[model samples]
Target: MTILICNSIIILITKTDPALQTPMYFFLRNFSFLEICYVTVTIPRMLVDLCTQKGNISFLSCAAQMCFVLMLGGVEFFLLTVMAYDCYVAIGNPLNYTIVMNQQVCVQMVAASWISVIPVVIGQTYQIFSLPFCGSNRINHFFCDIPPVLKLVCGEAFVNKIAVYIAVVFFVIIPFLLIIVSYGKIISNILKLTSARGRAKAFSTCSSHLTVVILFYGTASITYLEPKPNQYEGMGKLLSLFYTILIPTLNPIIYTLRNKDIIVALRKLLAKLLA
Candidate 1:
């Protein structure tokens, strides 16, 4: 998976001349880098547990894994929201897109997304880690997911529950609502275009982004937003797979497959390679 994702990023980064430094491409690279980070942060540890003779992790390692998974998950979701806004601006007002989304603003937005997610991650991780896990040593899922892992703890998990709820509202629900609002405005603007052709062109630009948002939010809403009982262990693991493993793989494909410019760029690069 790592090799595959690395090759994909290399192809994307080198598809055009090195000087093809537009904001859109820059955002693509950022997303690509995040995807790579997202996978690396969890997958190796997961595969190790599955493949190793004895799947054992120390308490600290488990805590670290949970924290990073939270950070990456939150960061990726917020980045998606930021990308939606970027698309909204690009399509809603093409002439002023560059000026409005200048380098400083872009950098600051990306940085803020990462920064904002850190506290949520820390809060949630602390909530889970502070509990006493005296029951189960093995995690049901391949990864150290909080909800399932917290069940192993033989303590009052009320603090963790409250913190997780607060973090969910702040990190996931609120940003998801913003994505919906932004897309609504974008759709409105696209519909107001003078002709069918213009509206189609504008809508095409955001469809890929919308697809990602749905997949992320739909799976996540099921996994985190819904209540989980101890008996529903299988469902918890399944939801974990959806957000962590599945989404990372699909995110790159969604961006590259539906993006017309990326397709054109890849074809040009391939032709040059063959020549």
Candidate 2:
């Protein structure tokens, strides 16, 4: 709840403040919005399951939850990739940064990230459910996730597992590769700077985002990319809790606390409210 409120406040601050009207903050606004949707998708259902102690989700509801969670997860990955490009441009081509990442381009990147995942998620949801679920209906995890649900299937889900592998490759691995490439260039550019202060400043600007990327991708990879779905069922749930529950709460802090612009904007907003 606290994280959701903070993310909402950040979104409002980014959208309303003229000083934050740059490509970086614009991306931050969308990322904050994504965090809200991301947590809402799973946390409410988790709470309900905890209270009821049954953890039973209807077939349709489970499918819907899976689709929304996958869609939002996809969007976050793509948005982070776009953010990496934005950061690379800001550092590697400072003079052309504004021109390169103009408002229209930023809007289009965000829109594309949100829109492009619809078909993919639709296919994934359909594929996962199309398989046989003839065994116990109780989902192992607090929320309905693909691996735990797959474990409940009466028959072999070899093809479904393969499909998940493909999807993970395209969605998770590809974006990570792009981020690496972007950061490689960013580092190269940073190293070229002679002034120690300039290099430190550049690295400082990117460190928060890099930290966020590491946290998000690390847990997400373990959740989705384990060699066998059933191998780490217990560990998987813990990892899922970290990413789905904990990470959203940490994101607002990660992005804002190191951000001077956000600090200044927040102080101004506080002053305005106090006045």
TM-score of 2: 0.98
Steric clash pairs (candidate 1): none
lDDT of 2 by residue, 180-270 (tens): 9999999999999999999999998899899989999999998998887768789999999998988888989987899998988898888
Q: Report the number of backbone clashes for model 1.
A: 0
Question: In model 1, what is the error at residue 220, expressed in angstroms?
Answer: 1.6
Best by lDDT: 2
TM, every model: 0.92, 0.98
Model 2 / residue 272 / CA error / Å: 0.8
- Against the true structure, whose TM-score is highest? 2
lDDT of 1: 0.78
Off by over 4 Å in 2: none
